[model samples]
Target: SIGNVLLLHDLVQAIPGEVVRWALLSAHYRQPLDWNQSLLDQSRKALDRLYGALHRAAGVETNGDEPPEDFLKAIEDDINTPGAMATLFALSSEIERAMTAGDHGVVARAKGELVAAGALLGVLQSNPAEWLEGEVSDALRIEVEGLLEQRALARASKDWPEADRIRDRLNALDVVVMDGPQGATWRVRT
Candidate 1:
């Protein structure tokens, strides 16, 4: 009989299914997984970082590029998931560099490769916007949106104090607002 087993239902109840899946795949298949809260937390953060990258590259159009050769080799070599995951983050770093250099073509290619690699690992399949949004309630989302709108208006009107106040309010609600060339985008603080 199984002893001290953690049920999938219990895990999914505590965190996102994708996060649980990520944690499960973090180790080699041949290795015994030392399941714990720390592993789950780390998995959640790692996924968040990946999703955040995709979110930043959302405007770029993917060019249908394949996953990098290194990533493919890692997966093919004894199903090295950890190595593949490392390659995905490397692709994410490439995306960041491309974005910083304003090279949309490279960003598009890297983003596509990252997504394809993630598909092989059964992760990062969720829409970046939706994944980053997590399980926030509709009411909370509406409230955050309203506050963001108000902050935008304040900034447009050069009302620095009002804008600061609105930003502070958002911080209190665990919402982080980022001002980009397009406008302000908000995400829940992890």
Candidate 2:
């Protein structure tokens, strides 16, 4: 065997499920693949960019910018992963530009194309919000919630400075707290 399955388990054990998928997805099928921690790390970064672009595209209307056909061409040529991934990188740039310009039609088309292309390659990380949040630990979540509660208490007691300080601290962690008539809720900052 090239590498024992049990031995490979250690290599993948520490990685997130999606990361394993990304690591494999990025590699050409017949080529000798180097399985390692760094590949998984790089996979996370690449997915972050691709998924981040999709999230950005979600808000804008499709601008009628059709998906480039090259990705499909590459796939048809016996699964040219490198070529397809390269094409996706370029498409990600296009999606970013369309989102920046608020071009609804182009954004919509680009997103669809991106998703379709990713789907063919089995690397479509659809839940960009969860992915982009970068795995918030439970302890961090609890701590953020605690600060939010403290902020609420400070506001009720008319301690504006304390409330503001709590908010600033949350801001530093990229946690966005929203105060509503019902209560306060928080989300990881985008």
Candidate 3:
């Protein structure tokens, strides 16, 4: 049974990182972990690392640098992010049900594993609407929007250098600008 679940979890994790997060969210909402300790450790460590950068940035000292407010806000938002706590509780409840039903002995041995999976799932489930909000802020959006607006002007003026500069700015923000027959369009790189 543990092996079966391991295979399942592995399969889930093997998918795109976004998919893994979504699946974890689903799993957290449906079941509770009761399996292996090692799995739990791994999951916890991942969460620690994933949020560490944001947390560290949040604690950054301006040191009279006068960093823009918008930049500071973005870091603060990431540091204060709230994920799927509800899903984890739901998952734990499901596990309790399984245990009560005299589920396989494998589950008993894999208690930590189960919790780890649920925790991992919880960590992954973030709101898609609020997702990119943490990365690119409203200020950044305004800047991009202005670029898109001036795109035609930049091209009409035969200012290839300026156009390329705008494109480079997008690239710096992890946006890939593509030049096609239909003109330039951009997408998030990752």
Candidate 4:
């Protein structure tokens, strides 16, 4: 029986505690969970997307909005965490859309709703940049930033091959680079 038990401490040592929590809550409470690396990976990515939305909307001001009705209804319906999580992702997408449309009011309200909903689920409460980037050593940060700078120069000079090579190198280091109107920003892969 002891051999069958997966220790929470061990899991947290390898994965973010919130991610582990997310994975456990992903299934219906009454259902048996087929726990595996894939489930953890999925949970991590899902959380990343949610945090990414929050990160993009960081500049907007929230007004203490509550979780949307659908989310509350799902939780009310047999503590349906899966449904609630889906609602959270849908809200994240809405936040993204609002950000793209330059609708700061909508973005702010949706972000507040998302954070409130996530609190009910016991996830997504961390600082988005810190959570998304994880912990990086100062030396490693400098190396990654230098490489990013080089990649930027390469791209600016139309040296596509060099830029691709640098990107591949960054991928090898488990650093994901995202390009936007503000140019390239990166997060260490979780």
Candidate 5:
């Protein structure tokens, strides 16, 4: 229990719980952590990708599927969390493939298995939706949209420097601008 009378008055700077969890989970227990905000940010993004795969698998039916045997074996061997994490990524890739194939049963079962396995590893404590939505501001979105438009105009006029400048500004704000054949899209830096 925190019994310090001045605790509230001197509340420490807070980092989000999810970020901290991911950051800690990023390294093995025996390894020293060079704790930093950037590490946490990267961890949060990694968690986002993991949950995004899960989100995509939502609404699929499961047929009593189980986590990969190898993953389970790795953890059972010696609490080899890093090994488990690697296995999780591999499983996620399989889930992604199943989702792409529209195999609802496989998708559902894969997700269920993943969640169960994650529980054993102290991960995936939050709902996929929480990480999926993220914490971007409406104002930031509007500003990014405007900047994207400016970038487009700059590119259209063969203003390479101007386009690059706009892109750099977006990067500064942690907005990832992806250009595809269909069009350009911006995502919050993950």
Candidate 6:
């Protein structure tokens, strides 16, 4: 989720039940979905702030956050960076402005920017192991090399169990080991 508060607010609003609180308590901290008093207050305040901004932009709630064409270009350039996610929020303001003025160009630009931002986000968050050359890291390379050596020795000694064990260990670490005519080849599992 982009922000813990935003995600939680969305969930609570969508599903009104007491069991959700229990689920939040049991979730891992990395998947932070808890709802504290401050977050609740902040969520409410955020809604108010958004309403005010929209009201100011259009005498009523109009188009949501959308970016202009120029803004989309910048979003494309830096969307790989983690900070770009938050920067995209500005699109909401631009959308409201465009709607208030009935500017088709601005609306189109904002739509393009929103699309580019979404695409960039998807690409950045996708698996990055496919393009590696030698290895993912020095440590992982060393570990896999050691395992491959052990695998070879096990095969020579006719110890199929040992060779299988080595492969299992590598598999647990997201490394797939393949035995081929040239020897063992390994690649990271994306």
| Candidate with better lDDT, 4 vs 5 | 4
Backbone clashes per model, in order? Answer: 0, 11, 16, 0, 0, 4
Model 3 TM-score is 0.30
**Order of candidates by TM-score, top first?**
1, 4, 2, 5, 6, 3
lDDT of 4 by residue, 1-190 (tens): 5587788989899889999999999999999999999999999999999998888887888857699999999999999999999999999999889888898888888999999999888898899978877799988889998999999999999999999999999999999987755467678987
TM-score to true structure, per model:
0.90, 0.66, 0.30, 0.89, 0.62, 0.31
- Misplaced by over 4 Å in model 2 are 1-13, 61-67, 137-190
lDDT of 6 by residue, 1-190 (tens): 5554446566767532222432332233345455665544443333333333332333223233443455455446633232343444565566557765777566555544554554543321212122221237888888878988998999999999998898899989898664533455566653
lDDT of 2 at 124: 64
lDDT per residue, candidate 2, 19-38, as tens digits? 78778867789898887768
Q: For model 3, state the Cα shift of residue 62 in Å.
A: 51
Query: What lDDT would each prediction earn against the true structure?
Result: 0.88, 0.75, 0.44, 0.90, 0.72, 0.50
Candidate 5 per-residue lDDT over residues 44-106, each given as its tens digit: 777776776766665665456466787788778676677888888877887888877777777
What's the true lDDT of residue 32 in model 5?
Answer: 86
Ranked by lDDT from best down, the candidates are 4, 1, 2, 5, 6, 3
Least accurate 10 contiguous residues by lDDT in model 6: 124-133
Q: Highest lDDT among the candidates is held by which one?
A: 4
The RMSD of every model to the true structure, in order and in angstroms, is: 2.1, 6.6, 19.5, 2.0, 6.4, 19.2
* Deviation in Å, model 3, residue 20 alpha carbon: 3.5
lDDT of 1 at 146: 95
